[model samples]
Target: MDPKPVNHAAWINSLGMSFAEVPVGTGSILVAREETQERHLALFRRSRNQPFSHAARPATQVSWTEAVAFCDWLTQRERAAGGLSFRQRYRLPSDHEWSCAAGIGHLESATRRPEEKSNRLPGHYPWGRAWPPPQDAGNLCGEESAGDFPDNFIAGYQDAWSGGEVHARASGPNPYGLYDLGGNVWEWCQDRYREDKDWRVLRGGSWKSARRETLLTSHRTHDPENYRSDSVGFRCVLAEE
Candidate 1:
């Protein structure tokens, strides 16, 4: 058999995305630590490509519709290059799929139930069963955030991020090698905020979040598709043939 074709996840950084392959059945849940600013500018703004910069942080303050557009652009780009098969495409992960990739256990049913609001189990946070997150358990409202959204900051806990800003993948990865699933930014999932698809669901606490509990793997929130915030960002996933 021909040697396995190159894993695009390993080399797609040129597009300003660093993807971690989740251990799923046929397709892996490819999650970027945060949305790539460079990719957004290049794809949406029609900006010319530029060298990568550490300052190119997560593309925040973008709406859910914009995020979906990015996925479409990526899908078309890959297919046009013959890099993706007809059966493969990149898109946002379903709420359940996002939870599984974030180390949250399985849900009883395929769809959401009123009782299953959160994805995590009892007493489980992204950093495990700890109360206050450890030194670096992912970015969240902490010492640095007391000045701004002080109302939201969790008292008596410091994730050691005083800059009060979202960070990159250096914070470390989860069991699935996915980064920023607990913090850094609230990631958008494919599910609707409610039974109807009007609002969209967002998981993972963000840098400005004031509650530590928000970082729990089961913690979830919702926002209108057109709403944008400095604390919200997203990642994409692809199906593998």
Candidate 2:
């Protein structure tokens, strides 16, 4: 079945979420330009006291289960409203899809699950291969972050935001026009960390990450599916079934 044409502007205004098309292998998927915000999450789930009180901040302290539930809720709501076709739905991007959106899709691994591909592009970062990072290179832990995370922060790197704060769309978009691919908050992916583990994968660094090892685009991390943290959040992908 053919998919309906999407009115990007109208969708953004109505849903408060914008997406960017990203090519993967033989097909493409629409990736949310920014992480899911608190305002959006509140539409489906009850409001809770979040560390960042701003409506535009990434919705953190969300478990993978909650995130999946949100995607299901959004799919139902949009389909009911005739905004999405039967074959179209919202879900978290897979680890490989996340890498493609982050502009590091070229690095392939021999592992069966693409999520296991890590540390392939050494010395390279989301903002290009440079030491100490450049200005406006997403919301990473820097000197200003020291006040909150006394020991975990880049020594000299700094961005516009202060006090290790996380703000959605605060940093410049990546080459794919996707924002916060490297920082602001760690984003959840659909795949498990490994075939033998039940842990789900997470990509992108967070405002609390300071080490070069963690900031690399090839870096991969995981947590139990039910785990939640102030630094972990997720973005959604719109694709055909």
Candidate 3:
């Protein structure tokens, strides 16, 4: 069997980004994209590293505000560097966008009960199921490769227990041809970090999480500004548009 390709530049270029693997600034790998330079603004709003760091709560090591700004920064960086259309735009992926990319739209459709708003997608867990039954398909955690556990897709959150920080790699990936998204770590979303000031919505559960609900694409958390946790981490998305 052939080996997987190692194309850091290609991967970064695809997302219109550039990465620097040092100083866990965002609580993970430090990435610089076109957004930081193009808009002539700051890449990460917070980007402040916390004093305390742990495998369970990575965010404490990364500032809550900086995580949100990274998306805007990445977008501008991509356009400036990749030569993409600035008018077209770049931004963080919303929960819906993430669901669409990870192939969990049907779950949203089913949750639109007859009593509730028509044509409204379910706002609960990613798949809308409290507990995914056996033999169903969910997605990856944080850093696990796809197809690692083909039958365990719907079984729930990737890490259900200890996270990937203690162990960098994990099993399998997802339908989107992405890896380790299921249970590696909790990823940051593009939303304003919260509906109000107290919290924001964090999607995709972490490896250390045991609850199947957290693994659901629709699952959310009351993430606050300047507050960081160990399980929290982030990935950037580039709109082909």
Candidate 4:
């Protein structure tokens, strides 16, 4: 089947960015412009939900307010450094926008159905069929520290599924060259939880996830501002200047 070429959203490519715009989806995607995936390691030191359960809490967890602050910092930093215009903005993808780009539900042949295109790209997770196939991809912090498992890596797991390295291996990069969009860590989104008053939305299942569907790009988890877990972290993106 010939993969249908996808079109950029009218808002993303044409209208450009309107900071206060409610966004096409109720969230923003954290986009990465470079291969280094920058400052993500700093997310683990967020200092947002401290006094949290270290056993389960990820250091990168932050409140909606904090997320907004981080976004603001990106714009201010870029502008001040003369690298980008102050008018430019960076933020997390709305739940809708994130899913659209997650490449989950997306199949090029499908008529731009939001559900189909999200998972269009193929891989053991995102990178490259579990790095070297059979082997797990990258290391997952929430699973067992940073480097606990050896044989269960991307080069070895191949297709054995479950209990592996929580989807490690550099092979699991997403279609955008983004790594671990499926597992490793459940990424934070811009929405407050749907039901509860919690102020955090989580996409992408964590190392703790067992179901394939849960690991899907569209599955979402909600969390309260006071709660933090090692399973949660985030990526970031900037709007075109």
Off by over 4 Å in 2: 1-13, 47-54, 109-111, 162-164
- Candidate 4 regions off by >4 Å? 1-30, 33-64, 105-171
> TM-scores, in order shown?
0.81, 0.88, 0.52, 0.55
Cα deviation at 76, candidate 4, in Å, is 1.2
Task: Using lDDT, rank the candidates from best to worst.
Answer: 2, 1, 4, 3
**Judged by lDDT, which candidate is best?**
2
The candidate with the higher TM-score, 3 or 4, is 4
RMSD of 1: 5.5
lDDT (tens digit, per residue) of candidate 4 on 50-140: 3433232122455545555656665665677776666567776555555545554333332343333334454424322333322344333
TM-score of 1: 0.81
For candidate 3, report its TM-score. Answer: 0.52
Better of 2 and 3 by TM-score: 2
Better of 1 and 2 by lDDT: 2
Reference-based lDDT, each prediction:
0.67, 0.81, 0.41, 0.45
lDDT of 3 by residue, 143-167 (tens): 2322443433433333332223422
State the lDDT at 158 in candidate 2: 83
